[model samples]
Target: MAGREGPRPGGRSARVQASVHGAVQALMTRMERAEITIPMIAVEAGVTPSTIYRRWGDIQELLADVAVERLKPDMQPVDTGNGGKDLLAWAEQYAEEMSSKPGREMIRDVLAAQDGGGAYQCCNFTKQQIDVIAARAAGRGEAFPEADAVMDRVVSPIMYRILFGEAPDTAHVARLVSGAMGLVSKAPASV
Candidate 1:
């Protein structure tokens, strides 16, 4: 019958998947531009409202995934032989990148979704960055028990200040990097 559950005789499944993907992409674009709604997205994608709701379960999950996808690349730390230098450089780059207009806007949108009771993708994204950094440090006979806390101290303030117009000092970054390294240096090596 070519209804919701049943497949069409032709390549309707593939077509439907493509349509859904395109619709999500378009809706996300509109979200970036500051205009986002289910009906508006359905109209833009030329899909029935129920289709998107049915396929994705809801708009929040879809948006959260998209937000997480966008933040993935920025969370990677660069290796520069020296951990402090590398960490500082990465922090500087992150601050610069996230402080930009587009980056700030994206952060705002992502935070909005989170505050509205959706899943917070930022935690997972930051966890990935911390895992990478901690693994590298561990391989070099270092430990980072407080890696997540350190990252929060170094990067979160900058992001928070930028997004909410709060004032945070530059020395905070220095302290965070140094404190993280100090903890790492104090850990015993494996025999």
Candidate 2:
């Protein structure tokens, strides 16, 4: 998975990835994590075990890649008619999701992959959501911090508390979002 850039837009590579990812997801639901293997995924996906290995390198990387794909947001964050409220709503939802049991497990799977591509993909997922929030705010003529600053000020702290220490409560999340919103009132406009 080191040099791999992911599947092509449409081709055998994309089909193989989608099939393999679906197999992993399906297998995870039906069997214990320890019971899964490259051969099992290959059979489920109707592909050869070598196909999985050639694309993902190993079972760990395959699982990590699948977890990152599962973590992608299917829809944009909620819009509350106010930029500050929107940020707060998104932060609160993010805190809840990341602190959940499944979320923690996904994070661990991503971290287990040696190449770190899964982690980068997961971070991009968060950053992309923040960018949407910033864009929405800007469209409403409201000022919002750059996506990177919001990540630094709001997201990093929440993730730290989620990954270490106690999971932050709503109040804690509120404060972080408040500070991030205030830190750059006249900040640039969108992501």
Model 1: per-residue Cα lDDT over 1-191, one tens digit each: 11225434548655665665567677665565446766676776677888766654556644544555566674368886555666776766666767777666557656655343222456566656767776776677655556677656666676677778843445666666676667654646784
**Which candidate leads the pack in lDDT?**
2
Against the true structure, candidate 2 reaches a TM-score of 0.89
Q: Candidates' lDDT values, in order?
A: 0.61, 0.88
Q: What tens digits encode model 2's per-residue C-alpha lDDT throughout 1-191?
A: 77866656888888998999999989989998889999999999999999898888899999898889988998899989877898899999988988898787788899999999889988999999998888888888888888998899988998888788788999999999889888765655564
- For all predicted structures, in order, the TM-scores are 0.65, 0.89
lDDT of 2: 0.88
User: What lDDT score goes with residue 191 in model 1?
Assistant: 48
